[model samples]
Target chain A: MITQKINKDNITTSGDTAHYTEGLQEEQYLTDLERQAIDHEVALVPYKSAAVIEALKIVQHHRRWISDDSLNAIAAYLQMSPAEVDSVATFYNLIFRKPVGRHVILVCDSISCYVMKYGDIYKALQEKLHIKFGETTSDQCYTLLPNCCLGCCDHAPAMMIDNDLYKDVTVDMLDRILQKYS
Target chain B: MERPLTQYIHPGCPPFDIREYEMTGGYSALQKVLKSMTPQEVQKLVQDSGLKGRGGAGFNTGMKWSFVPMGDSAPHPKYLIANADEMEPGTFKDRLLLEGNPHQLIEGMILAAYAIQADVSYIFLRWAYKKAAQLLRKSIHEAYAAGLLGKNILGSGFSLEMHLHTGVGRYMCGEETALLNALEGKRATPRAKPPFPQISGLYGKPTIVNNVETLCNLPHIVNNGAEWFKSLGNGSADSGTKLYGVSGKVNNPGCWELPMGVTVRELIEEHAGGMKNGYQLKGFLPGGASTDFLTAEHLDVKMDFASVTAAGSRLGTGTMVVMDDATCPVGFVHNLQHFFAQESCGWCTPCREGLPWVEKLLLSLEQGSGTTEDVELLQMHTQWLGPGNTFCALAPGAMEPLQSALKYFREDFEKHVALRRCPYQ
Candidate 1:
């Protein structure tokens, strides 16, 4: 399984907030698993920085979200500057720099979805989850976000929970779909 | 009408295994090309076939190959890239091709690599297509195991290495040069032309970037010959079949590889089984979200590049996004603008700043907070941010539906403002 259950107990009290403090060594940040995964992706690409996105994804996959320390570790491992890797992390839509809910639901809000009355579904999801775009639930179980076309326009009003796509979604179906995730 | 291109696509079949693919003559074109024809001969045959790029811009495919410098006089280690970042709003055909039969694309890439003498190639896929990405990786490895990739095949000296690189969700990366920048781990912004990908690309080596559907056509062109390919088109101007799709309130919303010049009327009424009950087609974006809106009058327009162009819209990706009478056109344009604004890589002044401003104006108009001046301003800005003005095609393409909406649906804009709220509401 690509997504292993991250230990929430360790995450909350790790004292690894996004803010960086002085005198923290680079080696103190990354785990052995993250270092190995980033190294594997770096070897596949021609340039060390070319693996930045994939490297960040590997880090996020394990950590749930990238903190400043984790970002520095990734940059140090790839031989890229910390700021260089941060720009990639922020610019790309998928990479989460801040904490997210356990499940991220990316709702498609482009032309096809709009024509299919995506507003109704969006309202339904917001009301049920008590969060709008970019907000995680109070329980930290789901984050609602608007995405561009997911290329499932043939089945308009589509969404993806993590990597799995749920198509032809309706307000009635949202409850059952969300049930499968959390 | 003949479905030669999508013949291997059996709906539920596993794509990772090459055995079923070879049983139905999958990589035979690669075998024939490697064993018999010279690289120059293969290039000539493709040129004769007149296959155009299936990406939004319909540039001639074989002509693109001819521009690359090859042999001892040229740069070493030329690269080939399969442009699989199909994120255009109304476009989903490439994903269908990718998920169905990947070997066809693999064989097509090998043929293109041989023609351009590219030793390294990359499939720049969009990150959201997680399933398609996984399937492509497995299929590529299967090809390598069978000796169809990496140092060659059945005693042939030609060698190529193909890699699958996923884009971290940027629409600008669909533009060829921007895609190159993204692959190199820089900001996904469009690069200047003249030092085109053919001459200088991907680590400063010559590169050829072909769309996924465009590359998928190669194996068929080689196996069946150029003449047979040309005979598939409904008109003289276009050749081969195209994968056309219809979305939004259609009874049968789907995509199919039909003849090149199929009429817009046939696509709506025949293929898509017409619009849904009680929902008359108000206006439709003829090709994806980035093309001009054509009304019921242009239903007879042939859905080919030149014909659609003659009717005042480009046949962009051959996929249509239909809007019904009940839907609000202003709100639709606002939704598209928001998308363009967010996706703007912030490369140029006009695209970065202008799109958001236009989107804000559209939002106000949709909320019944606009004057007549706003409509005129939108019309002017469409021409201002047109093709030659922007850094790349992204901004110009964004203007297509907006500009045409102003022309066809000016009354809808008036209704929202006149009522001080959405008249539809």
Candidate 2:
């Protein structure tokens, strides 16, 4: 369980940009579980930020998208400045900064997928979801996005919903795959 | 299957269990190395085995280890890294080895750590390989429980701790220095060489970064002896077997561990079961997308590091992505260009600025807006961005398929300009 207490202030300033931070309380701190996980990773490596991805993953697992408060809190807990944490977070393509849907679908359209006809599956998905790439559905259930090769090229035309991988996906298979997510 | 390198892999079988691995003489090599061999003896055995790095560069693996000072003279708390971040397009060979038998890799790492005299090791894996990661974690735990990992491994007084580090979605992280940077919790960018990882790496200490397949050979060399390893090669100095794969329009695309010097034809036709119906192979990226395209006429070229290089291409990763005559060469190159552009770390000017322009030119040619000048520009860009001109291999590798496409498929590029669109379309 998260044991960190929240400060009661409403406004948080990030890099000269002041905004109302939502989803997290004013005084943001790592939950005991998140802290313990980050500390464990830190103990393994010589430096703190070496565990940046794993730390962000724990925070993001709790909150769908890392809010500014959560980002600052993670940096503080990991002994890194907020800017350092933010740069690391933004550099990784997988870590989401903006609000994402309950489930994110990453369709790979790199060379192998392109050769294997990723267009048909991609088009079918956009039509069914009524949301183009990078756009979440009105119900906030799904957000479709494009990914580079997911290293499942042998089983071309692949996508990942959350952590599970679906490969050799045909135009007809997208619906069944997406249905399993919701 | 007779070769020690691939004896353990069986098609369609579940991941080999620890008992099954041992039943076929799995940890025996670890036991042999730990009990009998000195770290120097282990290093000399690898050198005599003639094994080269399998992750495209083909550097001498034993020589790479020899660069690090070992024992009392060597730096304390040195690191050994297993480069498992397999992100090259069309290369799934590492995945096969990692997923098929995790213990082989674990045993290999133990041997590698023992050789380098490093107390810590890391499996820097690609994030998408969740299954492989899970298997590695389980195997590491099993090895630890069995006293194969952690302190006093096999009661030999050699202790090491292994960790699994996953990179979040960056193709650049596959580069050894960039991988080190990513491991250090920074943006995945390539560091300049000369203070190579062998001398100064991972936290400014001596380190060794080896590919998954390269390290897997250690046990076989230890168990069967170096001369035996040398003889396993298909009559080449490049010893042992390699994990070769075929994908893209092949009838049965998959990976296999074959002798080091298998020909391209044997890999594509015999192992991959040939191209699919109605798809005559026009050409292929003999390695992954980063390699130059070899036409159908070159199918008999040996797929070893030296032979492939002698035949005008590197045996990069030894995996082939076939290009069927039915597919438009212009569109194919365009698709690959998009990947290189997106994956470019944007560090160097040539890669950061040039790759996207190349992609733009190719996309224009593919989509009917290409001029003759666009072809000329792409021709110029390929040479401008070739290897030695860029900071790392990514840009040069990015240019290989494009440059070769312009060479062999010149008519295809002309047709796009002449027809003002993809002629195949």
Candidate 3:
């Protein structure tokens, strides 16, 4: 369990803006298990905010998003302010601030993929799912995302549903493909 | 069935021979370029095809090549740089092209060099890509042996020498100017643009920095003609093939070759065999971790540079990281923020300080101890520090998904703040 005593020293003001303050009450947010994990892991990295960010990456990978308790626990573990961690989380695109779908679909639309017609693949998915990119299904069945190259250039115009690779796609093939998911 | 591209790998050996590659139809483009076309003709062909850069920036490839002062009065020692430092988080497309078909890249490089009158070229690869570097080096040697690399062609008098240099593994090095810095044995920070690589690159001389995959397309474009490649896609001038690496919760995860404009649903269902059992789809990071997040609703949004951006995110490196229902968004953002923070070069204050602060706030929310104020603070920080804050694209690219997450998943963040605990947990 997180300790009941919240350290005042861990609290600090946000650097970029005066309106914000860092370091909320640790106990108010963290569970005991999470505190233990933070204590064990956050200390292993460097002292810069970057190190804390790395530790948070570990937490997010497991939790899929950053939580208040995790932040406080991470702050305590890293001997830093909660605001510091917050700053790092908001700056990067890979981290998630909300829940995601059960499976993620990554489409390659880089220059090579673009030339090969990745746009068609994106259209097929939008039509089949009845949603736009960045919007979850009402039933929360799938989430569609366009992506850059996944290093599979020999097979141009490719997309990854989750981890699997699909190549040589066409509009007709795409129609038959989405049927499997339905 | 036709042989898989992987089968072309010569076991432990790096395949670089033109004859070896020609066994698979390599240099046919050079034959076509030399025999059937002039340099201006090839340039016109590429321009008409609308091929763009495969690197992070989507500049027109033909336009970039055309900038090289290519007349009898142009300066000497022009350079062609094959940017092989594939460090983008979700981008690994170049490695396959480099390792699998070194000769193709070599041919493309030669053709591009010939087009722009570049006498010297460098394949700037990341150090971690040891196999690719080795393969490219071996290929360069083989190309020389086969009279494809060194001093002149099948009697064309356009001599070019290729060298492979390994990067020290900094993500920033992937930036074209930064790569130049790293190549020149300096700290890898991106220089200001305008004297873009096309004009003042590589030792302050005229240079052309092309992505590995972009260069690989040359032979095909040269041999098949730009129109043929353009016709292969959706009849658009930008038509051609692309390779994609798919990862995350899908049943089958691997790389694939397909035509452009294919939809995300087909990729997940037919290509990736759909999501794993018992799990449902959630939002995903479209185009690697740098691009914005796209939920299921946007599945039909075309996976092209323009369309993806029109739908509000860049087609950055075309890497898609799938997210499943069981995943927590706060944790995910925190994780990605951690990467950006760790990767920050520390040259800029906003990225150095702002990224960690956001991570902290998200962490607090994730643990269920945050307030609505924390969410507001995150938004505030994202606004203040997102643009013009970093030295390179890393921090800005890092912020894309976070800003989008804030816009799309505000309720989830609020719930974490209100309840002080992750509902998913």
Candidate 4:
């Protein structure tokens, strides 16, 4: 397991103070393991905005999306203000600001894929999933997103469902692939 | 004919399968690396192979592996990243390798992971590489099922776990540090250097970031030995084969693996089948959009790292984007600039602001709406924004074609500025 260092003096109990209020609220947000990790690291690193972002990466990797409490915990652990963490998280497209579906469907639409009718693939996926790009289904089964390219120009019109990629996709294949996921 | 470096690619044969690849001694290198050589020995062999990084930067591969500190006192986990993010314009070589011969990349990755003492490796692919990603994931599963990956590979007590992490399609993600950030689930923006990816990368652990082609050479180097590999190319220092991706006005626009030090003329005439429709060749972006342009006068120049640099351009990815005489130089540069501008990632001030400014200048000049002052402004921006100014190599790379365009086709640009519209247009 990775080690973390924490500082006791920086911890405060004043409810009126914004830092203390955020800290008090964030304390409950962390998983037991995350809390322990934060406690271990909080004393040594000086908890800057960058550290908050880093912590968010770890949290999101485990939880798949950042909760407000998790964000506050990240801010507290990094010895940063929660607002600082929230701002950075919201700025980048990589961060999952809201809950995402279990499976991520990425359709390739770069120049080569474009020539190969990747737009049709996207439409097929949208129809099958009943969700537009960047929207999770009501059932939370799938989330569709358009991508620039998946680099297999030879096997154009491709989509990735989670980590596994399905290449040379057509409308027919899309139905089969979506059926399996559903 | 002399022995072809890429004898595997037949003219009319269907893409070779895993079975055919195995038949032609494909995994033989992986077996050799696993059975005979220790990880340290493999590193030494790669160091001796004189294999440089194929991903633009040309850093020595063997030397790069040595940078990772080993032993229990060092970092607990080390990571190996296969930079499959081939977003550089005219560079489609990695996509071919991933689609055509993924097992070769798998074998290479296994050897590299072993050498670096990394337990986990990730192929950070370009978002545009969906097909390649699919092929690679399937190959990884095959390797895992065969015990070539996962715990105790080939009963050698060495274990590796490989993952395929696809990018969201940004040119900047090709930068090693930015690639690392993207892998760790951040916005795909280049990171500040000092702590280069080798020392601190991928979940803040020691990482070795290698190009797809560079890693693919590993099994071959380990199997055939360094001396034999060195003899294939012309220069004593330059060793092994390069997958050359040729594009634009050439008669044949495709990728071909050739020995290093082959002349540009040979590549153009023999491999590329020369210019199409009897069109006269003007200039070429010798290695993708990043390198300086090479004119017909430099056709005799050898296509190697050192030779290209001496002739005033880095041999970046060996992607030759050729241009013909009928194409207006101003318009071509404008098109390229537009790509650079759109894909700038908008992270830094100069790249976000300067690139579009350069594009506007180029467009105005191409449309005959500018004076000579616009040309000077373009040159100034190109000089200011490259190398030292940026957080990573992307902005510097974006400047290569523009700088070279201004230098090689100043007269054409001047003509556009003077006439207020291109003659060809």
Indicate which candidate wins on DockQ. 1
In model 1, which regions exceed 4 Å deviation?
A: A1-24
lDDT for position B274 in model 4: 85
| Candidate 3 chain B least-lDDT 10 residues | B1-10
The alpha-carbon deviation from the true structure for residue A40 of candidate 2, after best TM-score superposition, in angstroms, is: 1.7
- What TM-score applies to chain A of candidate 3? 0.65
Please write out the lDDT profile of model 2 over residues B1-425, one tens digit for every residue.
45565676675687777888888899999989888889989999999899999999998888899989776888878899999999888888888888888899888988998998998999998888898899899888888888888899877999999988877888998899998888888888899998999889998889999999999888888999989888878686588888888888888888887888889999889988898898899999988989999998898888888888887778999888888988999899888888889888888999999999999999999999999999999999988998789999998998899988988999989998888878887
lDDT of 1 by residue, A1-182 (tens): 11222222222323333322221355446788877887788887777888888888888899788887677666656666667777778888888888999999999999999999888989999899889999999999998899999999889989999999988999999889888987
Please write out the lDDT profile of model 4 over residues A47-161, one tens digit for every residue.
2433444466568767878766566567665555545566567644456778888877877654345434566888777777788888999998898876544544435666778
For model 1, how does the per-residue alpha-carbon lDDT over B2-98 read when each residue is reduced to its tens digit? 7977876766676636998898888899889998998889999998998999997888888999999977799978999999999999789999899
Superposition TM-score, candidate 2 onto the true structure: 0.94
Q: Lowest lDDT 10-mer window, candidate 1 chain B?
A: B8-17
RMSD of 4: 8.1
Model 1's chain A TM-score stands at: 0.84
Off by over 4 Å in 3: A1-182, B1-17, B235-237, B388-391
Worst 10 residues of 3 chain A by lDDT: A15-24
Q: For candidate 4, lDDT tens digit of each residue in B82-122?
A: 99888776567887777767888888888899888898888
Model 2 chain B poorest ten-residue lDDT run: B1-10
- Pitting candidate 1 against candidate 2, the one with the higher DockQ is 1
Ranking by lDDT: 1, 2, 4, 3
